[model samples]
Target: MFVLELGLIGLCVALLPLSYVWVKASDDKFRKLVWMTTFLTLDLVMFGGFTRLTDSGLGCPDWPGCYGTASPFVAHAQIAAAHAALPSGPVSMTKAWIEMIHRYFAMAIGVLIVAQTAIAWRARFKRLPLHVSPWWPTALLMLIGVQGAFGAWTVTMKLQPIIVTTHLLLGLALLGTLGWLAARLTPIPVYEPQISRYRFAAAVGLALLIVQIALGGWVSTNYAVLACTDFPTCNGQWIPPMDFAHGFHLWRALGMTADGDVITQDALVAIHWTHRTFAFAVIAYLVALALRLRGYESLRRPANSVLLVLAIQFATGLSNIVLQWPLPIAVAHNGGAAVLLLLVVMLNFRTASSRPGRAAVPTRDAAPA
Candidate 1:
């Protein structure tokens, strides 16, 4: 089984040659590869959310494959049996496909990261406009390896809430790492002017945004989105009876409270309510960060990015509650959270990319050119 799985991963890795050849003629090959990985990571996060939302997380019911087989081919008989037994349970033909596809995308990303690590070190000794620290890709390769471990645990642990939530957090962390590396290695932007004067504030926003994402992940993993079933106020009340102790317990079984009791309605309400309330504060702070960047020409693009994604995030979030947890909107809401995250990471990277000896990127003076 393990050998077959390794071959599957190798098959995905084989595609990297095509991508590398396409970028081989470029002046900066590693830079393009890192950006491509970032793009795919964003999509992976979205599709992973889709799998969770559609209840396909346990589709395969095993780590890395569907019933000990690579493409769901050999597992057909077992999957059909399970679905027939439960009828509407987690395992199904369509769902197994979703899970496997998500895994394939993940393997492709892993392969690219490995290739990136090799290229960065190899190119360090060659002529280039900028020098990339081998540590950047080296560290990224390590992080993604850990991420792959969590992916396996996510299945073996049967989607335990804490385990699953941590898995999601790690995925976002990987995205941030790639974005930061790309910004550092990008020859053109390495010497560009810092976009935000409020670097300290942006850093704060990034930290707090991470906290907000953790809360959001908790909401999703616990399947608590519709607990309130109304927007602006939960269940049409300013305050609802909630069990925070049970809701916030970090370690527990899938649907059981920390005390091993079946989780209560009040606990679910608490999980949903805390996430909703905290989101307002996070949204406001991010908007402030975006507004501060509006004055800088170099920062305007990311500033607008912050605004646009935040708007979509708010819309999708509200629609999730009002629209009764529609799959498309929920998945898009997850994607919106990720976009908002990457924009902020990019903003931070831009502000910090000005190397010490190389003077800060010059700002556009108000005087006419």
Candidate 2:
């Protein structure tokens, strides 16, 4: 506890000086700082995926520290004991290092959010109306606290799949929130266009994709990626055996039956199969949306971003199965989910801001559609 407290305090102390220099740099420096923070948060999200993928989530077996130390150096003996006690268990020196690194990055992000909140509040009297409220960063700070609790539960609960999946989703949610806020801070003007009749459909599609992402997270957390192990087929058949009830038993232990026994093979298959089945729907919707948005110059970047992310997601998802769940591909698959979430959030933001006659389109005169 002392270690975690010290680390957090050090993070705050470090940020104050850096932020002072950044804010004093120029208006552009402020923008760059926000973007740098945002980018690092995105990287942090990816690193988080790496940690979870490697099953290092429980490395420290505690929150904000590894065996009561900020770094694994002092906790090395404790980690070795835990690892030797269970050779293939969750606690090892490597895993402890990964976990602590994640904590540090998370703390840094918290600092950035704090800095953003301060800047937003100060800018209110200094000509930046959008920065006046600071409500968004305030909300983010609260959400990060909740996320931290979930992180603790993730370890204490022994990596219960539901809690783990929720943690993953929350990270992506943070990414999306930051992305939207960053977009708002940019000089890009919002365009209120006469959206086509498919706006409702697009909204629906986006919502469904988000839901599908949750399902994917569930599948990953439960270690169900290899349950099926083949593309377009599960265990060499279109429909393999499944036990949805047992598979989705949310209250059960990680990879265990409701009775505290190890989970059955059928349950794993059930979880994996469900995600695979739903993915087709997600792909179709995204492809169609991408094709539709291709002709609209304003929507092109986001549209292409969606398509590119979808392709990367599909490839990485397949790679996870074909490569026997290699760490890189699995981590990439998780990162792709974050990327897609950000893209969808941006799409939502663009569509919302593009309401008819609400704001002028940015760069309208510079480029021809």
lDDT of each: 0.82, 0.77
Given candidate 2, what's the lDDT at residue 35? 64
Look at candidate 1 and give me any clashing residue pairs.
Answer: 193-361
lDDT of 1 by residue, 1-369 (tens): 764775667565648653554556565555667788898899999999999999888999987777888877778999999999999899999999899888888888887888777766665655332356667888988998899898898889889999999999999999988887766655433344554356678899999899999999999999999999987888989899999999999899888998889999899999999999999999999898888776676677888999999999989999999999999999999998888899999888766654355433333211101
Local lDDT at 113 for model 1: 80
- Which residue pairs come into collision in candidate 2? 191-354, 192-354, 192-355
Candidate 1 lDDT score relative to the true structure: 0.82
Q: Best-fitting candidate, measured by TM-score?
A: 1
Worst 10 residues of 1 by lDDT: 360-369
Q: List residue ranges in candidate 2 displaced over 4 A.
A: 1-30, 125-128, 189-192, 196-198, 360-369
Best by lDDT: 1
TM-score of 2: 0.90
